[model samples]
Target chain A: MKLYEHEALGSIFKKYKIPVPRYVFSAEMNDAVRQFVDKEPGVVIKSMVLVGKRGKAGAVKVVSDKSQVEKVFSDLATREVYGERSIGALVEEKLDIEKEFYLSVTYSTKDRAPAIIFSEHGGMDVEEIDPKLIHTYIVSDVRSVYPYQIRQFLAGIGFSDKELLRPLSEVIVNVYNAFWGSESRLLEINPLVVARSGDKRKIVAADAVVILDDDASVNPAVVYGARSAQGRPLTQREQDAILIDQGDHRGKAGSYVELDGDIAMMTFGGGGSTVTAETAIEAGLRIANLTDIGGNPPAEKMYRISRIILSKPGLKGVLVCGGTASNTRIDVTLGEGLAKALDDMNAEGKLDKNLVWVVRRSGPEYVKGLKMLHECFVRNGIRGEIYDSQLPITEAPIRLKELLIKLVGYKPEEVV
Target chain B: MKGTVYLNDKTGIVVIGATGREASQVIKESETLYPGIIKAGITPGKGGSSELPVPVFDTLKEAVSDPKVGKLLNTALIYVPPVSVLDAVMECLDNGIKVLYIITEHVPIRDSEVIYQEKVRRGAIIVGGTSLGCFVPSVGRIGAIGGKDPTVAFRDGGIVVISKSGGLTVTTAEMFKRRGWGTYMALAIGGDIISNTTYADVLQEIKGDPRVKGVVMLGEPGGSYEEQVAGLIMSGGFDKPVAAFISGRFQERMPEGVAFGHAGAIVERGMGKATDKIARLEAAGKKYPVKVAFYYHDLVKTIESLGVPRDFEDSTTEHVKPLYSTF
Candidate 1:
C-alpha cells in the first residue's frame, strides 16, 4: 500500500514526530484549505496522487499572490498527473531560504539489510550528483541507531555547523523510526530542508515518498482503503473482491487487478498466476484480470472472487488456470467453491452460456475437484474442459486460445 | 544425504506454531514422507501435550531442554504468524538449529532485516518467510514442497530446481518428470521481497553435490536474485547447466511501478524487468551453460539443449563397469 503525501504526513510523520510543514488537504476549495492559504505568506500547491514526479508532471505549483491561491488549488485538484487524477490538493506553508539534505531508510536488497542513505546534496537532480558525495550506512539494528551517531556523521561530513547538525540528524533518525513504525518498505525525504522562519529555525521534511508494506497485517494497510494496481481508486468489482480476505487469513483470493481484456482470469499462486498470465497473454488470450490466489483459500473466498471475476462485462471466456499445487486442495477450491459459484450464477440466469471456459489445476484431491467442476460445466452447458497435471501448466492458456478460436470464433490474426 | 547444509531423513524437526490446524496438516503430510523426523512441536503454552504428531512444548527452549529432542533437533519449520517470525527464528538460531524453513508470510520488512542479521551471525541456512519449503526427492522433505503425496508431484532423478514461487517449484519438477530426469532437489525459496535463500546461494551450495546435474530456475520480477545467479555462473562458481524461465513480462508493458500482486514480482522503471533479466542471462550464456527460456513450457527444451544427462549418473558412474551376477 502506497500512501499519498497527505496520508504519510498525517498518519506516519506526525506519529513519529518528524517535523513537517503545516498543510491542509481537500478535494475542493474547502474552509481548511482556504484558511491555510489565507494565513500562510506563501503556499505550495501539490496534487494528492500516489505517483511521483509531481513537479515534472506540472501537478505542483507555488503561489505567492493570495488572489491565485484558489485558482492554483482548483487547478491542481482537477488535474490528472501521470494517468491518475488528483484525489485532492495539498496546500502547504512554503519554507524559507535554506539548505537541503537527502535522507531515506530502505532495505537495500543487494546488502540484504536495512540501509540508511544520506547525502549532503539533495533536492531535484540528487540522482545526478557525484557518487562520493553520498554516504550510506548498513543499519545493523534500527532501534540501536542513535542520534549522536548520525550527529557525529553529520559533523564529519563537513556540516560543521553545530546547530544544523542536531536538528538535521534528529529528523534523519526520526525518518528511520517512522519507517520501522509504519512498517514501510521505503521512507524517503528528499530535500529535508534547513529552513528559517522569522527568528525561529527548523528542520522540516519538505517531501514524503513512502511505500508502505503491502501486507494486510500492517497498520497503514489496515487503516488505508485499498487502491488498484494503477494506484487509482478500485472498481466496484475490485472493491467487492477485496472483502474476501478482509479478516480471513485462511488463504489469499483478494489480490485482484482488473485489466482491459475479455477473458476473466482466476489464476492461482503468486508464481502460478504470473506464469499463467504470461502464457495466456502470449497465446493471444486477453486476460481480464490478474490474481494471486493460492495458499488454499476457502470455498467462501473462492466463491466471492469467482462472482467478481464473472461480473465483468463483455467476457468472451473464463480461464481458470494454476500450476500443480503442493498443498492447495483442488476439490475445495474448484469443485466445492468455484462449482457452487457457477451453479448459483446459473440459477440466477447470470451465467453466460456463450462464454467459453478452460480450467487446469492440480494438487490434493484434484481428481474429485476436476470431476465435480466438469460436472458443473456439463450441467450449465458451458463450453469448457478440465485438465490435471498431465497438461503442462503453461498449456492451459494455449488450450483456451485454441478453444476461443474454434468455439468462440476468435481470429488467429489476433495472435501475438 | 541431500547436502550437509540441507535436510535429510534423519534430520530431527521442530514445528513452530505446531498446534495450528495448518501446521498439523503439514506435520501429518510430511510424516508420510519422512516418518519420525518431526520430533517436537512449539506452541508457547501447549507444553507436555501431544496434540500434533510430535510432543508439544511451551517454547523452543523447553523443547531443546528435553534429552529426547535436544541432540537430534537440527532443523526447524516455522509456521508462526508474521510478527512472531523474528522471535521464533531467533529461538531456533539460539538452539543451534542449523537449517530453518520459515513458512510464515507478511513478515514485516524490519523483521526480515533482523532475521537476515541473525542468519549471518549464526551462519544458519534460512529458506523463507513465504516459502512452501524444500525437498530432496532422494532423501526426504522439509516444509510443504511436494504437498501430500510426494510421488504425485515429485520423482527422484538428476536435475535440481530452485524457484521463488512454491507452486512453480512443483510445476518445474513435473515438467522435468515427463522427460525421465526427475528433480534431485527442489527448493521453494519463497516469493518474499527480501528472500533469504536466493538462486545464487542455493546454486553455490548444490554445485558440488553429486546428485544434482542441471539447474532449473523459476524467477519473477523485482530484486537482483536472478542476476546474482547469472553473476555466479559467469564467475565459474557453479559449473552446471542452468535453464531459467522468468515470469511477469507483460507487466513491463503496463506501467513502471505497479506492483502486480507479488511485492518482489514487479517492474520498476526498467529495473527488474523481464527483458533486462533475459538479456543478462543471455549475455552470461556466452560465458557458461546458461539458457533463458522465453516461454514456461519451453524451459525443459532449453535445458535439454545444454546436453545435461537424462539420468542421475555423474561422469564417474557413467564409465564404471557393472558387476556380473551368477545366474
Candidate 2:
C-alpha cells in the first residue's frame, strides 16, 4: 500500500541510515514551523495526505518567513487533496540545493524483475524529462543490487566526475537497501538534493514516496499497523467485508469497493470480477459497487455482501455473475446466499419495486441453484432473469441490459 | 518430450499442509472421487498421524525418506499459509519434487521472486501460488479444480484448456462439455501478479502432446502474459488451432492505477490494457492464424469451426464413461 505521508517514508529512510531533511509532523497550525525555520533559511510545508501530486494540487508550499508559514500551513491543512482530507501538515527544513536528482525502484512486468530508474533532473515531473537523461537498470535477482551496476548506470547518465559519482552512488545503494528491506513495491526519492552549504556538499533525500507490498508474510507490521488497501482508513463497507471474510475459513468473500453507478454487481473470482465489470459497463450498465464472492464462500458471507451492494443508493438493478464455478458450490453462493439476501431486502422494502435482478452461474448443483433463485425471486415478487452455465459468461451483461430495457421501462439508450 | 509437462496415471502426488482445513477438505473429496492418487501428507508438527489412508510426515525430507513416498512421489500440492509458502516450496524442491502446485494466495512478491529463481535453477514446473491447480480427466485431479464432481464438466478429449482464473477453468471445460467436446487437460495458472507458470509455458507442453488437437486460453488484463502467448503463437510454437479470450476490456475506461479485481489486474502507464492485449493477439493471429474470441461463447464456435477431433455429434444422446465408475 502507499505510504500516507512524507513522515512515514522519512522514518523508514532514517532506519536505513539514509540522510533526509529534518522534519516535524503536526496536526495544529501552531509553532511546528518555528523550530524548522530557525534551523534552516526556509521551511517546506506539505499536507499529510495519501494522494500524490500534492505539489500540483497546491498542497505543498515553501516559505522562508514564520509569518508566512502559518498562512500556507492553514491553507493546505484546511483543503482536501484528491478527495482525501489532510490529517496534518509536515514542516521540514529546506535544503540548499546545488543539484537535484531522481531515483526510483519498482518491479518491471516486462523484465519480470526489479528495475531502477535514475535521472539527473529532479524536483519536477520525471515524465517530462528528456529520455536521454534517464537511466534504467533491471536486476535479474532480488537478493542484491550490485554497486558496480549503480556505477555503470551513473556513468551512462553522464556522471563522469568521480567526486560527485561517489556520494550519489552511495545514496542510491542506501535507497535500494531500504527498498529491499521493507519489501516495497515502489520507492521513489524525488529531488535527492546535492546540498552545498558553506564548504560542505552532502547528498540527502528531500522527498520520498514508498509503497510497501500488501503481503504481510514478508514483514508483518512493516508498513501499516493493520492490513489495508488504501493508505487511509478503511470505509465502513470495506471493514464489514473484511470482517465477513475473516469470520470463517470456508471461502474468500472480501475486497469490496463502492463505485458510482446504479447497478449493484456481485462477481465471483478476481479476473472474473474485472471481466464482469467491464462487460456490464460495455452493455451500458453502471456498476454501483464491486464484490468478489468466490472460493466457495458460505451463504452467510454472501448474504452480507449482497445486502451491502443493495444498500447502496441510486441502484436501479442487481447483477450477479461469475465464471463457471469449479469448487465453489453455486447453490450456496447464489441459491442460499444471494437469493436469500434479495428476499430479505424485498421484505424490508430496501429494494426498489422496479429493480431488476439478473444472475448467471454454472457449476455442480447449478440447476438446483437456479431453480431455488427462480422460486425466491417469484416469491418475493421481484423482476429477475437467470441464466445457467450453458450461456457463455460474457453474455450476462448484454442479457441483463436487454432485460432492464424491457422490464424496467428504461430507454434503449439509457440501458445500452 | 524433454520440455513437455503432463499428469498421468504414473504421476504420484503429495499434499503439503494436508491437515489444514481447506487442504483436508480437498484431500477427502479427492479421495472419494479418485483413490490411490494422494500418496502422502506433510504438516510441520502433525506428523505420525494419518489424514486417512495417506500417511503424514513432519517435513518434506521426512516424507521423501520413506521408501513408499520416495518411490512414488513426483508432484506436490501445496496448501500452506502465505507466510510459509516459500519455505514449503524450498523444502519440496530440496526433496526432489519435480512438479509443484501451490494453492496458497497472497505470497509476498519478494518470496515469489526467490521461489521463481530457484525454480528456474532446478528446472522444475510450478503451477501457482494462488491457483486451484489442474485436472487431467480419467487420470486424476491434483487440486480442488473441477469441484466436488469432476465429471460434471470434464472428460478426456482432444482439447487442452489453460486459464489464469480458477473459476473460468471449469467454465471453459463446461462449455466444451456442452458442445459434446472433452478436454485433454485443464489448468489454472492463478491470477496473482506473478504466477509460476504462464499460458506460454502450458502452450509449450500442449505442442508436444498429440492428444491436444486444439487449445483454449482464458486470459485477463494485467500482466503481459497474454502478450507473451501472442509472441509464442507468432513464432509458430504450436501446429493446432488456438482460440484465445482476453477479458477486462472496459478497464481502459476506468481510472488508471485502480485495480479492477485481481492484484495483477491493473493498467498502469498504458500497459496491460485489454485493448492492447487484444490488438497484439489479433495482429499475431493474422500471422500465426490463431482464433481470437471476443465474447466467451465465441470460443466454442471457434474451436468447433476448426474441426478438432470429438467423440459425439450431439451431447444430448451420448453418455461418456465417468472417470470414476463408482460415481
Candidate 3:
C-alpha cells in the first residue's frame, strides 16, 4: 500500500505537467513557519494525517495573519485527528478557486483490473456521488492504455470547456500511467479545483490520496511511501492475523476482505480461492471473510491459520477450498488442526450453529483425512454434514446453497 | 504400449516432488485410471519421509538406490519447479530413470530448451515443460495428484487426452466425470507450451497404443506447439481421430495491450490470435474438428459429441468416489 504525503501529492500535479501552488513539509512547525512568514494572506495550514476527511475533522485551516499560524499549527499538531493516533499534519498555500472535482484510478477487485473514475462535482464525500454520474473505464490489459482514450473519457464526463478539458485529460492519462507504472491500488484527487471554465482554467488537487499497488512486487520508491496511510485500515483482529502470518514465515498466509458479503472464507492458491469466493458471492451467500492456506503448510501451521480465522467474531462459516485437485494437495479430513479448532469452539460454545463447512480435496491421504472428519463431527455432535467428494469442486457452491436452504427453512431445491 | 501403458501390476507411482498437492491428487486419481499401485513421494530433505501412506525420500538416488527395490516399475512423475528442475531431472537420468513425466510449470524457456538439447544428446525420452503429467488407467498414475475424483472422468475408453492447461484438463475430465464418460487415458501437458514433448509426441504414442482410438488436444495462445502437432497430423503422421479446442477468443474484444490471463497469453498479438490457430487446424484436415469453449460445461459438451468409441457398457451408473471426503 502507498502512503503519499500531502507534499508528494502536490508534486504529482507537477509530474503530470499540470499547475499547482507550492507545497512544503517539515517535521517541526518552526521550519514551516520560517518558510511561510514572508507570504501574505491565502496560505492554508492543514494537519496532515494519513486518514481522509481533514475538512470535517477540523485539521484544515485558512490563515491570513502571521500571529495566528502558531495556534492553528499547535491545535492540529498536538490534537488527535480523525480519532486516529495522530502522526503529523501538513500545510499548503490556498488556491485561487472556482470549482472542485474528483478523479481517481483504483484497481477493481471485481474486474481484477485497473479502473479510472471521474466526477465533475468534487470536494464532498465521493460516496455521495451518484455512480451513474461518475464515469468509469476498465483497462483489461496493462499495456493497452493510450492518451486519446483518456481524452475520450473526459469528454464523456461532460467537460465542455477546452481550458479545463486539456489539463483534466492530461491528469487522467498521467494518473492511469502512474497507477499501472507504479502498481498503485488507488490514486485519488479530491477537490480537483478548477479556476473558472473558459480561458485560463487551472486544475489542481486540493486534496489527494495515492494508495500504492499491492498485487505486483514493485519497489516502494516507484510508488509512494513504504508505510501505509494511518488508520485502523483493518480490524484489530485482522491486524493480529497478519501478524501471525508474518511471524510464521514457513507457511504461505494472507487475509483479505471483499466488501460485498458476510461469509468469511480461507483457502489456498492465488486463483482458485478467488474463483470459489466469486462463485459463493454469485450464489447469493454472504462472504464473511477470505483467507488462504498456501503451499504445503504443516499440520500445526494449518491449525494456527484456522485459529486466526475462527477467532474473528463476525464470521458465519468458512468454505475450506483448495486449488484444482491435480495442481495441489487439498486437505481432505479437515485435518487435526481444524478438528481441534472445532473442539475448542465447542468447548467454549463458540461454534455457531449457522456454521456450514464445505470441503473439496484430493491427493494423497484423502481417505484417512475424510475418516477423521466424520469421526470428529460424530464426536462433536455439531449440526454438520459433509459432501465427501460425491461431487466436483464446482458442486461446492451448489451444495453449500443446499445447506443454507436447510438452515433458512426453505425447500432444499429453492432456486436461490 | 503407449499413452501410459502399465507393464506391471503395481498401482502406485512415485512423484519426485511428492510433498506437493498435485502429487496428492494424482494419487487420488487412480480410481479413474483403474487403481493398482501405491504412491511413494520423494523430496530432497525428507528421505524416509511419509506425508500420507506414501514413503518420501531425500533424493531420487536414495529412493532408487536400494537393492530391495523390485521391478523397473511404472513411470515416475516430477512436480519440482523450474529453478530446481534441472537437478531433479539429472538425478532421474543418473539413476537409470525411464518413463519420466514432468508436471512443473514455467521452467524458464531457456532451461527447457537446454533440457531438450541434452535429451537429444543423451537419447533420453522426457515429457513436459508444462504438463498436467499423465494417467494410466487400471494400473498407476502420476502428476496432477488430486482432482475431484479422476475415476469419475477416466475409465477404460477409446478417447485419449493431451491438454496444455491444468484446469482445462480437469474441466475436460470433469465432462466425463460428471456424465460418467470414460477415457482410455488423459494427459494434461499443461501451460502454453512444453519444450521437449509436443502434441505430436503424445499423438504418436496414442496412435500406437491399441487402447486409444481418438485423441483430444487442448490449446491456448502463445506457442506454436499445437500448430506443430497439427502439421504432423496433416502430413499423415498418425491416423488416430483427433478433436481439438483453442481458447482465448474473448481476448480479441478486449482492448489491445491488455493481458488476458496467464503470462503466456501476452503473445496473442497480430497473427497469434485464437482465430489463426483454428484456421491452421482446419487447413490440416477436414477430420480434425476443433471446438471453442470459454467455459468448462461448453467444453464438456463438445467432448461428449466427438463420436469417439465408448468402452464402458453403461455410461451413467458408475459413481466414482471423491478422492477425498470433506466430511
Best by lDDT: 1
Off by over 4 Å in 1: A125-134, A151-163, A198-201, A412-416, B1-4, B312-327
lDDT of 3 by residue, B25-137 (tens): 55555435444454456777777754545666777666665544424333567777556676677777767666566666546433454465556656676777556666655
lDDT, ranked from best to worst: 1, 2, 3
lDDT, each prediction:
0.82, 0.77, 0.58
Q: lDDT (0-100) at residue B95 of candidate 3?
A: 70
Using Cα atoms with residue i matched to residue i, what is each candidate's TM-score against the true structure?
A: 0.93, 0.90, 0.51
Task: Put down candidate 1 lDDT per residue, B140-172, tens digits, no spaces.
Answer: 888877778778667777788888889989888
Off by over 4 Å in 3: A1-259, A266-275, A289-296, A311-317, A321-333, A360-363, A409-416, B4-132, B138-140, B144-153, B158-178, B188-299, B306-309, B313-327
TM-score: model 1, chain A:
0.94
- Positional deviation of B122 in candidate 3, in angstroms? 12
lDDT for each residue of candidate 1 in A127-169, tens digit (9 for 90 to 100): 6668798887777655487888888777776775687777777
**In model 3 chain B, where is the ten-residue run with the lowest total lDDT?**
B260-269
Rank the candidate models, highest TM-score first: 1, 2, 3
Candidate 1: give the clashing pairs: none
For B1-327, candidate 2 gives per-residue lDDT tens digits of 211364777777899999987788788888898897888899988898955568998888887889877689989999987878899899999999989998887778777878877888899999887788888886778888887778878877777788888888888887788787888888888876667898888888667666777888888887788898888888888667888888887666655455556667766556778888888888887766577886767888888777776645546434322111100
Residues A17-111 of candidate 3: C-alpha lDDT, one tens digit per residue: 54555666544577656566456455676776666677888778887777787777777765666565444556677677888877887644223
